[model samples]
Target: MNVVLFNPRAQKAHRRLPLSLLMLARVLDCEWALVDGNVEPGAEQRLDALCARPGTVLLVTVMPGPQLGVATPSCRRLKARYPGLTIVWGGYFATVYPEAAARDPGVDFVVLGQGERTLPELLDALRAGGDPTAVPGVAAWRDGGLVRGPTRASVRPADFPDPPYERLDMERYAARTFLGDRTYNHHASAGCPYFCNFCAVVNMFEGKWIPDPADHVVRIVRRLATEYRADAIEFHDNNFFAWEKRVVEVSRGITDLGVSWWGEARIDTMLGFSGATWEAMARSGLRMVFFGAESGDQDAIDGMEKGGLTVEDTRALNRLARRHGIRPEFSFVLANPGDPERDVERSLALVRDLKADNPDCEIILYMYTPVPLPGMYDEATKQGFALPKTIDDWLSPEWAGYDRRRNPRTPWITPGLVDSVYDFETVLHARYPTVSDLRMGPWQRRALRALSAARWRLGWMKAPYELRLLQKAWGYRRPEEMGF
Candidate 1:
């Protein structure tokens, strides 16, 4: 069977291949055509021209935000051109909200949960000219009615197929960097054991943390380096350090290969690992590491149910990573339930201190958007933050019919304010120069002020997206110097 997998773009094309489609192709054992939905302006026309082929089944993968707008229209056009083709939709968005996606006229089937086994089974049934109505994990329309199948079981990371890189556009991605120079993506483990109130990982993976064998993961990394020439890899595992022995083995294997990679690790894991282990990871080409330091305030951290690491533990983790010559990046959540002004001030102070004390430490702040999956939204609403009427409202403007709802409990700041603060932080970091003394040089400070003045003069300060696009375009033109 000929299967065409589409990746709809809400932003510029990133190098990572959609792992789900790769698993699907392996399961079906079919010839696949992969297309980037973000082509130059008339690229969709070119896509339509290519998709108008005989005996092809179109499977478009979509994410929740802006990508849905692109995917829905593209699917509609593809179905209009080839009425006999089977069009299926799956991804984060479809899995979370299958009912809304099933309502779309262009979607023939919506596969929920893990698609590894279910997708192949659906394709097999189609090949046998069997009815799709009874297919598990698939939602289909039959006889003018919607039929929802039973939920499918989740598959382990070890069970997924090796991603089909040969079938994808490698040249376009080769020009891009993975986390600023890394080039591979891997999931050594599947699922997150922690039920972070605002996370979708637990919901998607059903709170199951299954780690793949160490040797199997190492073999995959070896292939990525030898075949793909990937200098670095990003372990996409939700909690990569959940299994210590597996991490140590994988680290040793990659170190043996002389390839560098980075991944998410918990603070406790870093502290648990002896200094020698961190040294081994550094020797193995692990350049960057990310820790989920949700907040510096212990109370806010407790409120979010993230009690794994205290502020001191996080500081120690940062010091350990720096001591190993590894760059540590902190992933933090800005606001949480019952958080006060003092909490925000304390968090910012911690960030400032980290920057001052550890030059290699980088801070990434993410807003605590309440997802309706399980704990987060209900808790936030109970704390008196008004949620949007539906889940779709939380999506960004580029997505179709997205409505940004205001939170009554957190009336001190608006969602727009949070976005702007992040944007400003990016601009500030980009325009300013880092000094060994942990102070911006005079010229750097002047440049930042000048840039701020220019932005204000042109009314760009209020337009975060526009300012970001300009910055990105500028960065792309001189990527070698951009450090990204």
Candidate 2:
């Protein structure tokens, strides 16, 4: 029997470590092949070769956007060619919407939540001719309906084995970004602790966070620096700063390694970190942090249950990050379901304020996309927002765009309003081109800033055709899209 691990291609410049597959590889007590679609030119060919034998299991990690688009077609083609092939879908999409994958004729099983413990058991059941869905965190198609096992939180990261870096081509995973030429990625923590209603994490993890100890994180960092010569590390955790002491310890231990790091943290949580902790973070080369200043309105923040985060917290963090020389990349969700236009205007005003407070600060603007949880999702459902019933429907252009949060066409937001939000973003990008684009040099940066200066100042952001053309010519990528 042959086992293969697959990560569907996300997009260009989106190559990072396939952490999900690596974690599963460490625990799977069998010979397996790992193929990363992002780096492997012959990913499908390699998968076909591995999955030729009888009882071959192909495990795929899929996200909601571009990855789903590619994986859907690939799985359909493979299933049609090999009747004995077993396809299993995991990752964010599978956990959040298991029926979408389980209902698909190509996918035989769906792994929910975490897979370090569940996947091996499911494979054993399949080999023994037993019920695969009996394994916790496994979902499968039985008869004509979907049979889902019990959902649970992720297991402890400490119990997992060391990263299986030897199994992968580290040079391919190493990426060029604002941090360094050879930036790599790691997920040191389990799910996030807070339950932001609009966030997809809630649907899967239900507000639980488990992190590896500080010493363990230090060991990994040292190994990456000494063995792989990695100059930077990006923590792909849902929230890396959940435990203050762990972050402080990790920061101090990694200081001498000279590796710049970045991670996501809640504004309210980081604002509570002591001055000493901030000093430790700065000394350890904490280059940047991503915060979900979700909305400019305090009411919306409260409604979303962001763990008591306030609009003022966002402002204070911007100042604090400036003081520590750590750049703040703030992402705002524009156009709330209720009063979409007003929500956007308030957020735009806050964006201006954030830029004024810290000119070097980065801003990411995303249209509001509802997850399957309460609060906003209920509002969305009332406004005719519904999940697709079949995998093919998810591959449609509108649903694909919805997954990316760039073009979600919620009924609440009007076409005119969407255009206005995008126009504002275009001007914002022109005036403050992201520093992440290593190719944009001094003169190019100056030209962009100068060209969009008048429109930004006069608040005339409508129809900035010149700015759009120049951006396209330069091939600019926004900070949000760059995984900042």
Candidate 3:
């Protein structure tokens, strides 16, 4: 059976290829094609082109929260055109809400958790004219009811090959950096060890961390550098520094290849490394590292069950990273459960302090968005926040995940606070534009700042989607920068 995989475009066109779809394609036994909606003119055109070909038995669409809405209409259109097409939904969104996802008429199956093994197994069954219900980690509709199955075990990273970048138009991809032209995205591991209450990663991976062999990761890096002519690499792992020794080994391996790289890590994990270890990583070309400094106040951190993390820890780590010639960037959440006004101020103060200490340091500020994860969704529900009750709810344009830039307010976050926190972040983005923001010109930068100030002053403004439109009009963003 011929299988087609679709990746709906983000709000902005992204150069980084979809790794989940790539991985799924890697293990599939039948003829398969990957259609990226992000680069295409429209999702409908892409789907129509694929469906025009005969003998296409199955269609798969991967959902990252933001693109779920974009995929809904395209799936419906394709189903109408090709009634025989078996539409399957997978990836982060389906893993969390299989039943709700299956409720959508366009979606015939929902592959929960990981899809590498599950997808191939399901396809094999379909090819044999066997019951798809026998496949684990899949939810399908049968007899007017949803049939759900247990998730399959996570696969070792070593067992899977690097993403199938050869299937994509590599030249069409570009990184966000000035040097992003030759940049590529990669992952040496899957899943996170920590269960940060607000994070859906833990729920998606069932709190299990699976890492690839260090040597194998080194080989992949070397291949990327040698074959793809990649000058830079971004390790997209959520917890790259989970094991200090493993990180050191990987860093040294990359250093030997003479390629500069960046990745994200928890602050405590970075602190856990000794001075010499960090120095080794820095010397090896670890140019930047990101930490989830979720909030500035300890109470806010505790409220999120972000264990043992403190503002002090954040300050120390940023300082140390700068000392070692590694740029430190942070992500701060302005609104959280029970965060008093003072707590928000503390977070802003920390952002200012980081910039003052090292103007080069990057700070990304975000309002607390309620996603359908256990700890976060449950708490938000208690606070009178309603979770998306069905697939249609998730596909709603106003869904919180659609656009973080626009208003996606939680019940706990008053409209005034959302405006305040967003205005604060916009100012910071103007002052210390991240290293990746090398393309924005001075005129555009000033315009963004002025726009932010105007929105903030007009506190009565209910919803502001125009700012995002303005940002695009000014050529400040890539097609993949914003979610659709």
Candidate 4:
């Protein structure tokens, strides 16, 4: 069997490792080829040469928003050209909308959540000229109907083979970031324990969480540090700090490696960490952390079932991170269903308070785009919102921005509200340019800060044309736009 895994163009010249495809490659029993559009020029042309064979399987890892738009047409043309080729779609986009993905002309098979198990099974069936749709966690349009197997969720990363990083040019993925000169990304964990109803992780993991053992994680990090000369690492796990013991162990192992690192965590969970754990994290060179501080209202947070996180908890976590000298970047889901106005008002207020409490804390404001789940999505439905049922519909101008998390096209959120959020974000970022933006000079930073100081302090987030002009002129990179 000829299996070629393709990572569609996601970011612009961003050197991100495709850990998803690498994981699948590790477990594949047959020979396979890998092409990353992020790094490879003429990625589709390479696929064309590799996929011209009679029994070729073109596996693609797709994300929800922009990547889906990118991969759809590419795969469609590939399929149209080589009608004998088999195209399989995997990753968050396929897992979230398996049936819809199956209905697409390009996607022949949709691999649900964890592909380590299901993908091999589906391949075994396909190799035997058997029914691929019969495999568990596989979905396909067959015999004029959509056939879907049982739903799949999270699994242990340790149970699988290590990511086959040796297959690719490690130097291609070694990009410089705020953490250090050369940075590489790793997903050490599989899922999140808590199910934030609006989160796609909850839908993929079903409230289950799993992480590779501390020793395994440290081994990989050690290799990246020693062999690849990576001075920093980013743990792209859904929840990197899911288990504190493993975190401490990993931290202890990496303490002497001298590699700066970053990860994501929950506000309430980290607040419960002992001082010893906090110290270990700091000594490990943990520089920054991301948190889903979903809302500013305690009641609203409680509604999201974020493990009893209060409005005060975000503030407390900010202080904790500050004490540890680790910057905390909070992502807020604004203009949520029902009472969208109140949601925006309270969340933006909290953003201001957070900045005041800790100058280093970063605020990422996102419009609430619901996953196809219960709770908030039901509310979104009540307020006239629905997920696109086809690939083309998802590419439409209104829905294309859906996964960017800034401009949600839900009816409850007016254009004024979206602009208000953008305006405030512009002023806020101008006042405090992101440290992730290393290209920004001291003069430009001082100028932006001075110009936006009055607007930020006076709560004047209207238009802010001056800030926009400077940001456009200087090519300022907001942390949100940069995907930090």
**Model 3's lDDT to the true fold?**
0.73
Q: List model 3 lDDT by residue over 67-154, tens digit each.
A: 7777777787788888878888887777766767788877888888788888887887777888787799888877767797766888
lDDT tens string, model 2, 363-382? Answer: 98888888889898888899
Q: Candidate 2: deviation at residue 44, Å? A: 1.2
Score candidate 2 by lDDT. Answer: 0.88
Q: Give the per-residue Cα lDDT of candidate 4 at 182.
A: 89
lDDT of 4 by residue, 1-484 (tens): 9999999888863478998999899999898999998889888889889999888999999998778987999899989989989999999999898777888999899998989989889989988999888788899987777798877656788788778878899988988788988899998989888888889988788888888899999999998899889899999998999888999999999999999999999988899999999999999999999999988876667667677888899989998899899999999988876677887889889988889989999888888788888888888788778888888888889787888887788878788888988999999999888888776789999999999988988998999998899888887887766642
Better of 1 and 3 by lDDT: 3
By summed lDDT, the worst window of 10 consecutive residues in model 4 runs over 475-484
As for model 1, its CA RMSD to the true structure in angstroms is: 5.8
Give TM per candidate: 0.80, 0.98, 0.89, 0.98
Query: RMSD per prediction, one decimal?
Result: 5.8, 1.3, 3.9, 1.3
C-alpha lDDT of all candidate models, in order: 0.66, 0.88, 0.73, 0.88
